[model samples]
Target: MDSAASEKSIIALDGWLKSPAGIYVREWEQACLDELTANIFGYNAVQVGMPQIDALAANRMPNKWQAATRMSNLDELALAAGNKQIAVALDFAELPFASQSLDLVVMPHVLEFAAEPHQVLREVERVLIPEGQVIICGFNPASLWGVRQGVRRITRSPYLPVAGEFISMPRMKDWLKLLNLGVTRSHFGCYAPPCRSTHWLNRFAFMENAGKRWWPYLGAVYMVHAVKRVKGMTLIGPAWNKKSASASQGVPATNRK
Candidate 1:
């Protein structure tokens, strides 16, 4: 709605992230990010949103930064960072960066929460270099968690920014394709039911592999990787048209004659 309302929603979201369910989500997401980002080669890498998730911890990129819409303390990020790194306040719809400057961008639960998710993806495409990798983490709308959220919709009292429009995999793939980003791969995780009790979560731990094998796309969350593509670019050597090119042909034999 308005900026004030958005800010309030964010606060509530941050609160849920500290709960048991949220902790479980963070653990799964952290592992997923580590696995996905470990082999990714890049110089400049950024993680937009999700301050609770240390998105770049597993990434070995030399220049790593976190961008957030808002945070408890601006200096908190820098202080936690041993060196000069810090989180920059950024609006997902509008990022301040030169075109094709970033080699990698990791978006952890930014789109589903955004008012205009399409614009955020557009901004992501704009900052990333050609062939740059972008890793996006989001809740799967066809999972147990989704079922819970759907039921909550019937009731007035929902949890953790339930108003967000959770996008599905096929829809996101289409969006990525439209942005000229090729789909690389995807990860499914957090298969356990959305239970707040740690005991119940542990009880359902076996569901992870079961979910992966039986209903892979139905995991509670998914991580998608895509690479940007720039078309119609080719290396140019010296023009060698035989009909017009006398320069490289026998040193102009007619002139010598």
Candidate 2:
């Protein structure tokens, strides 16, 4: 609910929407949207970023109502999706909504730019029901795009105006665990390369397909589907046990007891 953070997020989102890479990013985002729409476990859903695009992609989903927020694009997209409920605000990393109020939360590249990713993810966990699903799409820091960024840095030139951390899937998985969420499935793709000149490479689909199946670690982006675990679930970890001595004679006890 920080107004300043909200403004920054809005500005960043606007810039991204106007970028060439944003188009490809949106295509990847649509993949997540399609999955979410197909699995509406609740009557209400909320999209955290790029509400307009999400609404457009999720137009056919049946829900009592869908709400989207982030910057000012909510209204137009909501109208297009035939949804009347809309919330205009920012700092989605720290949502103002009540606990377990939403059943589904879709984040498209929201984590890559987040200054405090863990905080944002925890907030997402807070707002989702126990069974709610959080679908996230983020850039892979260890992929071809990552290599391109490294080259840019080496040459003292960068594609993105603002530099942020490129999070890996393993790191994100750990973050989810800290928030008591379990990752059920993950998909990685965008192997066509990060250069604008290589846009035609996407038409083949073979690169992305084979890359995801055979070389997930090298995919440019990754989509993860995580479900919030019910509170108080017992988590088992490694256990270390040592033999105890008998109280009477102080004799060493066996491991059997």
Candidate 3:
């Protein structure tokens, strides 16, 4: 597709997000993000892409930013400013942050749409401080939705954005492992089949619980929380208390004698 067509599709997708299916996705993601970021204390945090959804709203970081490749319009920028969120327009593959500066970085459905997903991950690893955390949200290509999308593709109609290149969980894990980003916590959700109608989706609500127990890995969406692990770096703690050590060791050998 040409740039013009791609832009049009993106705009249509923006509309699609207001549909029942989109609302379902947003609700699940928002709840998961809230739980994941509520206790993540940090000085600097950023939510990259998807300005429409404030992924870091639950976080208490002193400095939180909304970073996107491009703002859909000036109103969006004004709204972000009104919300006291600093918004920056920049390329994901070339973030304009200093190395080891960010304590937290959240990417919401960014990698699939990015031109160079690997390079984007590299930038994330570069800007994060040691032990800093990164939360990633993505569409799983091993789910019922994936199967639906596959079938639709054969007939030239796609269930998801034509631009998205969904990545599987194992593949995403491998990418993070290569950058020494150790997976700490993760979740899978959205078990309902690919249905645009709200009523049908609600009918399958029971599958959410059932899928988690019977086929947890087959959920349509996944969230991954990883911490940057620096090689050969050891966290230092306060020195042992001399008095406590002496008490535990008892009196000196000569005194005891």
Candidate 4:
């Protein structure tokens, strides 16, 4: 899509996020993000796109940024000012940060709308330090919301943003694995059906508990926390080989006895 079209779609997404259904998604994602990022120790962190949601609010990182693809994204700039966070405008596929410079990166609903999602992931991997974590929030394509969106597409009025191409958990994991980012933790929530009205949404609130217990993976949204893994990296442990050999030499051989 052209830049103008992309910008329009993003603006639409922002508006959608303020709606009742979008608010429901935001609340679940925010709680999950807070829990996921609270214990992460990091010097630098960046939240890419969807600036309305402060994905790094719980993170105690000394240096943090909210980045967007264009400076025209006013919501992020305003949010950054309020939160006292540095705001950056840069291409997701070519981040300005040096290789292995960032400790954490949070992406909420970015990949689905990105032009080159794979390249964006590659950039994320390149910028992250070894063992650094990346938290992603995405819509699941295997849920009731997904079904609704698919059906709505036939009518040319998608329930979600038209630009968004929801990625399945399995596919997302494969993308991360290719970049050596191992998924350390994951969560699924927002089991409610795709109801645009607030009343209907509240009525289905009971489905949250039942869905988590019975059909966990079929939630409307998912949060994934993955850590970067270095090739051939191993932890140094105490040497027990020499002590074991010495102890064995002092023992009598069973065959000789």
Q: Which residue pairs in model 2 clash with each other?
A: none
Per-residue lDDT value at 169 in model 2: 92
Clashes in predicted model 2: 0
Compared with the true structure, model 3 gives a TM-score of 0.89
Best by lDDT: 4
TM-score result, candidate 2: 0.74
Model 3 per-residue lDDT tens digits across residues 55-99? 887888889877754535757655853453655544677787899
Candidate 4 TM-score versus the reference: 0.87
**lDDT scores for all predictions?**
0.80, 0.68, 0.83, 0.85
lDDT of 4: 0.85
- TM-score of each candidate structure, all chains considered together: 0.85, 0.74, 0.89, 0.87
For model 4, the stretches where C-alpha displacement exceeds 4 angstroms are 2-4, 74-76, 236-257
Instruction: State which candidate, 1 or 3, has the greater lDDT.
Output: 3
Q: After superposition, how far is residue 201 of candidate 4 from its true place, in Å?
A: 0.8
lDDT of 2: 0.68
lDDT of 4 by residue, 29-142 (tens): 988898888989979998888867788889898898877665454664675535636555556777778899999999999888776789889999999999999999999999
Point out where model 1 deviates above 4 Å: 70-72, 79-84, 155-160, 234-257
Total clashes in model 1, counting residue pairs 3 or more apart in sequence or in different chains:
0
- Backbone clashes in model 1, listed as residue pairs: none
Please give the lDDT score for candidate 1: 0.80
Cα deviation of 210, candidate 3, in Å: 1.2
Lowest summed lDDT over 10 consecutive residues: which window, candidate 3?
1-10
Ranking by lDDT: 4, 3, 1, 2
